[model samples]
Target: MPVIAVLALDGVPGHELTGPGMCFGTAARHHPHVAYELRYCTAPGFRGTGSPAPFRIDTPWGLEGLADADTVLLPGHAGFRDEPEPEVADALRAAADRGSRIGAFGTGTFTLAATGLLDRCRAATGRQYAAELARRHPRVEVDPEGAVVDADPFHSAAGVLGGLDLCLHLITLDHGVPVAIETERQVFMQLHAPAGAEDATGPAIRHGTGPHSLGPTIRWMEAHLDHPLTLNDIADHAGLTVRGLNRRFRAETGLSPLQYLLRARVQAAQRLLERGDEPVERIATRTGLGTPANLRHHFQHHTGTGPRIYRTAFRSMVAALTWADGKHAEPAEPDGPAGADTDPGPSGSADDRRAARRRT
Candidate 1:
């Protein structure tokens, strides 16, 4: 049985803390042998605060939980004014060093990123916080997409229920896609969430000239992953000759334009697979990978799995997608220090607070 240690920090969001509890609990109950034992740990002091401790947490599970766990889950809170207390950050770093798969529910991703494990890794976080997560951790590839973001050892989500996606994905990774799909059928009463990139950071491309020459163009390619876009069209928009675009794009983003486009298409195709919608052929066309044969060509070439099975195993949200609203979503500093409270936290009983978000 894999023991999942969920860290309870001061001011941790109740929903963020509880979402994993419910889904993983369901997994354990249904799966049995591969069941997960969920542990909750608190920080040093809690009960002394006047009005709900800001996080609605009166008691935390303490330091010991980090030592014995298969997976470590970090739930983000609004108070991200700085990196966690030294001991807390150390424990998080230690967990990362131990080969334990590290997870962050929301802004909690920032915590894990601070541990240096996220450098150059792709990931996701709460919609309200996508910008900051990217800016604060420049080395980490923070997906502006929605719902869920994942890069192996590290996984994150956009809003409340994203925790469900994370747990379901873990099941797939641990057991098999078939088992995960079955579990989703049992819990979601729907097919598994789409695979590929999430839209959490959907369209949330970082603006400005620094990478505008490069980042903006790549961002555009990512968005059109589902639409039909030609290299010439992309070059025109980027204001470069096809050859120039190819050269500059590769030098700047480390990928040729077509290569990057293909990657985005594959990622989108994965998400489509997870959504369980549209026939594979249409999904391929929609994502610009084109035809079952073409999709198979790229998907098999890149991921080693055909589209259907890949969706069953690894799909989450639209990969690298920032929601449409995120484009104009309220602007924030894009970086909050430890203990800084930027957004509103959850409230009510633990269960209600956890369920408050339907699919944020």
Candidate 2:
């Protein structure tokens, strides 16, 4: 289990503290086998600077909690303009020296910058505070647009909600895309969707055949994954020239048409591998990859693992989550080999898993 230590300071934003807690807590609920231990710590005599609300929060640990942390998060506080205590700075430095990942959000970037770890690194905070952040820390590159900047062990996000985005990114790093998506869906369900609508598993993408909307074209591409689709064919279907399609795709999806197609195929293959006992060659054929060798190359590129290994890891994780849910009398293990008699009992449909994976 990875340990996340949240450095709670005086006046820390309640949302900042709760955001990460909620994210990591959701991951634990869905994937207990790889859960993270969340620890909140404070310096001696510390009292949070209550803003949006007036309140006081007491923590269970001290600066020492950061010593063995896998990741340390610093949430925004009211006194961010002021320098952190010598002990706080020293503790952050020590954690970084030991290879712990450090993250900050909103004006908390100022506190992390004060520790000198962000020197010569790109960082972000609320857009309004970007100029002041750069002015105060000449050595640090501050992005005014407030995009999330990940400088290896040090990461920072732009605003309060950006803090949640940062936490979700960390979840993706620690537990893979599927787990992160599930956690994100859970969070959104609590925030936006009404009760009894939580089990919805439709593709988040909207579909339309009009020139202005690629949703329908993307959906078409997904449905025709087994066909050998050329850029020209896709462009023709979208009523755009090759160059126009490329531009529009990059603008809307951040991926070129062919890149999107390849990812779709890979995703299709992953779903099949997870849900059924199909041979690699058949899966490759069904997903339009042409050959098992081709599938191996692209699957490894996208997932950082071969199909067999990915299937094993994925199924084991699913089984663990299922067993933890008390859905079975005995904890189930993944079926042995491709042709074995195995039961993938009660795992949600491939569409559900795909929806969860693509939520982020």
Candidate 3:
């Protein structure tokens, strides 16, 4: 059996934190050879404990509990911005360094990235934080697409409840499509099952076959976009004998790794500009794109509009999406029932699509 140690940090989104435990718990019962043994480590002062009694209780595990696990799962939480008192990062990084497969859900992706374990690795997080994560870290590659990403042993899901997608894929990959179909039929929720799986809930993935198949060096390059990285640096990090990572990167993101990084920088600059908190040069440096002139060039090329205008326009849209006469932001859709791509995250539909079109 493959053992999984879940670092049940506090403030993990209620469902995201517990969902993996439940999914893997079910797997343990449903399959003998590929069961997951889960243990939750208790940290006395973590954000996830604020939930009501049932959610914020004691666990049987401790930091040392992660030692023997084959995979370590980190659930997302908003509280990760603040450093933890315990040697939390050490435990997570240690497990990751040992080649244990790693998984993250919701904001948990942020924590994983923070350990620098995910440096030069392609990672994904909730849709809300994709731009922010990229800007702040400047190194990690975050896919905004809803599909789960598996690079080597690291599997990540985007957005809330995205873990369901990641978890289902894991079962299908290990147990075969028929077993996945059996499980899906028994379960009552809609899942984004990639193609080739007999019981997939969505379109199949036509590339890479699986996550672990991605190039190891490419993974490292995506993880370290923050530092002054060159193609040589990336190749060296991935332990690839050649000095060029461009071809593989082009294959992965439809652009060379540097091109992808620049594009990502532009996007990050745009997001921060919208927040109305920084100047263009600062935003450029922060995004790793460099210069007001350079930002203007790409910003104009990408959106057919200049940076100043984009930021002004985005700020206006933000105001309209949240406040009507200066009110607090409300749910994008409060009355909508559970469904596919329900909440696209704090934004306006008509304006957003229009803006997104402009970017494309």
| Candidate number of the best TM-score | 2
The reply for model 2, stretches above 4 Å from the true place, is: 193-360
lDDT of 2 by residue, 1-360 (tens): 788999888877676777888778867764434568899898765776455554677667999999999999998776788899899999999999999999998778999999899999999876556666777899999876556677888988754442666787777777677666666555643443346554222222223335577877887898899999999999999899999999988877668899888877887787777767899999999999999999999999876679998777666655454333223111112432343222223323333434432442
User: lDDT at 200 for candidate 1?
Assistant: 21
Off by over 4 Å in 3: 47-54, 84-86, 189-360
Go through the candidates in order and give the clash count of each.
49, 5, 20
Candidate 1 structure quality by residue, lDDT tens digits, 28-134: 54443346778887766533212122345433357778887889888765456477778888887787778888878666777778777789888777655666777
C-alpha TM-score for every candidate: 0.51, 0.55, 0.50
Instruction: Looking at model 2, report the run of 10 residues with the lowest lDDT sum.
Output: 324-333
TM-score of candidate 3 versus the correct structure, residues matched by position: 0.50
lDDT by candidate, in order shown: 0.62, 0.73, 0.58
Relative to the unseen true structure, what is the C-alpha lDDT of residue 43 in candidate 3, on a scale of 0 to 100? 57
Query: Which candidate leads in lDDT?
Result: 2
In candidate 2, list every pair of residues with a backbone clash. 10-48, 10-49, 11-48, 11-49, 208-216
